[model samples]
Target chain A: MTTPNPTAAILIIGDEILSGRTRDANMYHLAGELTRIGIDLKESRVVSDDREAIVEAVRALSAKYTHVFTSGGIGPTHDDITADCIAAAFDRSIGVRDDAKALLTAHYEGRGVEFNDARMRMARIPEGAELIDNPVSIAPGFSVENVHVMAGVPNIFAAMVAGLLPRITGGKPLLSQSYRINRPESTVAEPLGDLAKRYPDLSMGSYPFNRDGAFGTNIVIRGQDGAMVEAALMELATLFPAEEHS
Target chain B: MTTPNPTAAILIIGDEILSGRTRDANMYHLAGELTRIGIDLKESRVVSDDREAIVEAVRALSAKYTHVFTSGGIGPTHDDITADCIAAAFDRSIGVRDDAKALLTAHYEGRGVEFNDARMRMARIPEGAELIDNPVSIAPGFSVENVHVMAGVPNIFAAMVAGLLPRITGGKPLLSQSYRINRPESTVAEPLGDLAKRYPDLSMGSYPFNRDGAFGTNIVIRGQDGAMVEAALMELATLFPAEEHS
Candidate 1:
């Protein structure tokens, strides 16, 4: 059997998320991006901006997965302590690196903004970490070993992923196709279960919905093999023939 | 000193979310609700619908937090294995509990639908577990000790939460106030950090935004004490002095 694809975990460090002040946009974005790049996103965790919590999760996820991506807490505020936590997790010392400082220094100085201590905080990269280019913002995200520290802001996060994904060698891209049936999920579960048994290598998920008082289920079949996914979708489409509005 | 409020963690079990086919709605909904009820939402984790993963997460979160709310994988489909995992985690024998089976039976009977084996899967609850009522859907979620296993569907999960929250006693509701300053986050970080140090009990988070070619920062102050939060917000207002368009 072929070797299993590389696995990944996301560690979202933010008090804003845990406190419910902000709904997560970063996790969703990264999950989709990672899927597109063929990296299996195994687990995602949102933790408060507490040092112990951040360090523990960082170490655990880093050890468990092929890659551990972290978002939030890399900003220029006291609450932004992810860089320090990552350094501590790997037992390395953190400091304001000259290269990182130069990037921010140039960006701010060009805009006539002072590279103050607050802005300089963004330049605090862990020792022996490579900078991930940020096209949206000047403050760079860093990657130390297996952990990729990214900015939490949605656009910046997306930009960093764009720059990072191309550098990592990913496995086959997962292909998926979905079928919508105008029946309740309970009615379709048995057949779906049988189909799942037939295709043991593929994953089938049924999501139910109630829209305009009509009960319906959306069946999504996914696998690394595009032909298999297409065949399964074809079989599903034939079994649950499309209705007028389906 | 006040007794610490009960802490909670959200465990989202769904392969659909891990694959990025679906974004999480249940976690965000529960997070806000728990925040309002004075329950500290310590962490939120999303794991795949694998048995070992679910069981390990359930055992870990259940042990660490006062409550563990899990969403997804309790549906009628074959992929739905949350109830089984929870049972296995707690070493409880699981079968079709009569009370739960009867509810689904009657609901299906009333609607003139046959309650087949697929539908019967919903009634499988662990021994000696309290049923969490799902008003929207007749299939009941069960509470195995501290772990509350709910449906993956957003509406069903929410209905179960609405029924479940009333029974739990929460501490003082965490109160929060926010101020929008036209200055960028880097510019406001120093003062916001100072304010955070002054009010050790409160959490201060500065979220930066860019809209209409203008950059601004939204600073949120949170604490269990309402008056203290008010006092801090007032002080923040005085320090920043809200601008006309702010």
Candidate 2:
């Protein structure tokens, strides 16, 4: 058993999200992908397109987790200050890198578009950082220290993650099994609590839902060991003795 | 003009969210509502069901923003440790409150169900805290210092926000206007940057979207002053000289 699973945190940077104008897709996508690969997504944060807030979040999350992934604010616009803020977080210098510029230059040139100053902003990278490939867009994401700064756009973000995840070392993949009880959480809380206590290694989560006036709880058991998870699920099933919904 | 709008942060506590099993609804709901009432939702964080993480987030967010709203972990289950975490963050004692217990008791009794010990856990409140009414469920949310602890369910969280927002004093409602350019963000970044600099009081946000293989940007200008926002939008229109989409 891997004693300490690799942990990660996501930092979403965009005013559009904070203003409730855009529903976040990056965090949700990253969470599922990270979990499938055995990295525990311990925390996630969404901050506006502000420099101080981004820098502060970067420093804090980077120090706390084994990996930190940031989405948004890497666009051509003036509000896209993520690159500079990330640099400040690590006390590193930032400038337009030739390799990143070459990628953007070739893509734009092939498309018969001018590589203007705004577009060139995409090439800005912190010193001593590795580039993360963006297959959808030519603008590349960068990894400085433990933090990976990627695009905010969902398609581009997804492409970058596909290229990046396999490079990072991961522990045992977390396996989860859930049982849906047709009773309210209040009915299952007591016995479920005891079941959780018995299997201290696994994580027990109860999600209550009200579906068409019928209240129910979806109890999920997560751990690295599938055998332990199966045992706990059996105990939970015996304790509840209800028809399983899932 | 309200020079500085009231700022807020949301701390969502649940393992289901971090594990990617649940898509968050409360944060999006609160963000729109807070923006409508002129409270800037500056930052939002999702932490697991760990007590240390919950306490740390509560303390950090409460100090940074004028208001902090928390969702989840207030339920009857053992993983519902948010109430205790809130108390610990502020160095206060927490226990079942009479008023809160009475509410839950009447609710369960009306439904012809027993108000068991687990159900009574919903009545836990921190010292010197005020209850936020939950019309959907009898479980009450509370506000201690600047932090407001609310439920995780979408409906309950919305109802609680409806009841809570009116009581808190708010500045002028934030007004916004958007212009959609058929061109990419790279095309609109330069002129929009100028427009933002011209009207420094207004917040300029550019959101890029790809619809049916066509890329476009929706430029939004927001501020307390409607006239300033309108003026900025007009300048933005002239700068772009294209058909407005929004």
Candidate 3:
């Protein structure tokens, strides 16, 4: 049995997110993708455009997790300083990159948009960094050490992450299954606890959800081993029978 | 005019959020609410269930922002140690509270469900903490110092936050207006930049949005004064005319 120690984390930066104007859609997509890649995402953080706060979080989480991903604040606006702050975190300087510039120029050329000074700012990369390709938007994301910096906008960031994932070293994806039991967590806690103890590798969760003014619980079982997940599912099935489809 | 330093921030705790399994819905909701309340949401962080991570985030954000609201890991599961970790951040011990016990017991009684040991675990509160009433579930969330701990689930967390907001001190609520500019950000950047400089107290944002297979931009002006918002909107209208609903 392999130890589940291959870990990853994310750091989301933006003041727009903190004030609750835009609901973040990137976290779920990243989570599902990371799980499939077999990287144990152990932590995530959201900080604003503040340089000190960004530097502190990046330094600390990078030391703890094997890989770190950040989203947002890497734009042309004055508040967009994710790249500079990351460079500071690693004690590096900010510099323009030839590869990133070429990509940005090509991207704008295809769309018939002039690559002006404000647009050129997108090509700036941290010193000694590798670019993460973005298919939707030509402006590339960058990686410094263990930290992968992606865009804040959902469409662009999601596309960028998709293009970048295969290159990273990841473990086997975790197996998870959920069943909606129309009962409170209390009704299922006893049996679920026993099942969890029996299969020590499996992580069981009971989330109580409200649907149509009635409460129900969804019990999820997750584990690295396919067989272990199957075993947990079998026990759950015995407790709550599957609904027959007509 | 006040320095407009009514500060607030959010601390989201969960491996799921960082790993990208759950895209955070709470951050945007809190940001919008705080903005309306004139609390400048300066930072947001997503940390895992690990003790040190949670402790560090709570300590840092609470110190930086006037109010720090956290969501997630307040469940009955073993990984749900938000309460304990937060208490540790404040250099306090976790213990069962008589008030929480009474509230939880009454809540379960109304639903005709017996409160077991696992259910009672939800009643654990940090020393010298006040409760944030959860309207959805009877299990109360606690606040010690300026750190307000709410559940990770969106619905429950939102309800608790709505309940807790009136109790905290807030500055003048911000007013905002948005105009859809058919042209790209480039066409508007120069004028918008000039407007931004002219209105030092207001924050003018030009967001590029995709609508009906064409790229459209929303130029938003946000500030505490309604008169400032109206003045900015008038200037922007002269630059980019509104779509006539003829």
Candidate 4:
């Protein structure tokens, strides 16, 4: 039997998401990325930028999951309190590390801008934390214990994730396949239920839809074992033989 | 001083969301709707279809928030165990109620389809629960205790929310205003910080953006009092008057 993969939880730290002023792109993007790498994303939480809230969520998620990836609250603004909260969560002291400060110092000086106190806020890191590279912007995200804290901006979050993923050793890649049956979900449930029981390890889901007054259900089968996923999909396809669309 | 609004938490129940097969729209939509009515969305969670996971999340969220809204896993399939799980969370007895079955029975009969066991599964709501109307489909969502469970489909979820929200008593309507400053967030941080401190009741956020190599920050001031939000925006405008977006 294949060993179980590491479980993860995403802590999205922001008021914009909670207030619904901004639609969350970081969680969606990170979910897909984590899945491809076989790190099971068990759950995700979105909380506001409040200090107590951030600290509580960080501690709770860190204790529950193998890894916790957080997006937002790691910028150079007074509202950006993720770094300090992370330190408080882990009971570690946080200050401006010389290395992180140097990166920002050079980035600002090269652009003919002063590395002022407001800008220097980005260089604050918790003690014993490793820096996460931010290629899009010079200010870096950091990894403290099992939690990886990153920026809230879409492009910078994506870039930091791209650079940090290679450092994480993932389990077997998750594989998936889908079949669209031109029938209502009620009609498709019988076979799909039997199919699910037949392959206990695989995950099967039936999503119903209506298109131009025609009802349809998309049955998706997902598993770590590629052969088992293909076998189940083949069995399902034979029962409801139709044009193939993957 | 205005009374604080009721707090909410969203528990999204589906493996599709956790596994990255689906991007969550319900959470984003609900966040915006709750804000308009001044039901503060404190946090949101996305969990898999596992029974224990669903039960744990429901109980935790229900205990902490004034209302806990759940979306997905209430369908005509084996994987649709949200009804049973919600019952388990509250320790309430669950079975196919006559009224719910009657709705499905009439619905299927009118469409010339049999109301089979799979379809009957949708009628299995918890004891002491009030049914929430579904306009798009005959299958009804329900509210047991403080948790309001609804369908996961975008259109149906929106429809269910449209019907369910008016029943809730909300606080004062949340008001907001924004000004886009064509300056780096670091430059805008000082004034925004002072503004936030001046109006401790209002929430001010500085969202940084890089538009075609030009740095800018959108300063948003939000509060339940329209006059307070307006006054803050005016103060901000006087400091750096360029243009108003919201």
Which segments of model 3 are wrong by more than 4 Å? Answer: A107-113, A239-246, B15-21, B239-246
Chain B TM-score for all candidates, comma-separated: 0.96, 0.95, 0.92, 0.97
Candidate 2 chain A TM is: 0.97
Error of 3 at A118 (Å): 1.4
TM-score, chain A, candidate 4 = 0.96
- Per-candidate TM-score against the hidden true structure: 0.97, 0.97, 0.89, 0.97
Per-residue lDDT tens digits of candidate 1, residues B154-232?
9889999999999988988888898999988898899888889999888888888777768788889888888889999
Q: How many Å off is the CA of A54 in candidate 3?
A: 3.1
Q: On residues A1-246, what C-alpha lDDT tens digit does candidate 3 reach at each position?
A: 646757887888865566566676776778788888898877666676679989998998899888999998776655567899989999998877888989878877888888876676678899999999877656789999999999887888888888888889888788788777887665666777777888878777666667666766777777888887988898898887766210
Candidate 1, CAPRI quality class derived from DockQ? medium
lDDT of 1 by residue, A1-246 (tens): 234789999999887888777889888888888888788999999999899999999999999999998988888888889999999999999999999898888898888988899999988899999999987777899899999999998888888988998888787778889889899999999999999999988989899988877788999888888888999998888788876434
- Model 4 bad stretches (over 4 Å): A243-246, B243-246
lDDT of each: 0.89, 0.91, 0.79, 0.91
In candidate 3 the C-alpha lDDT for residue B68 amounts to: 92
For model 3 the TM-score comes to: 0.89
Clashes found in each candidate (C-alpha, N, C closer than 3 A): 1, 0, 17, 0
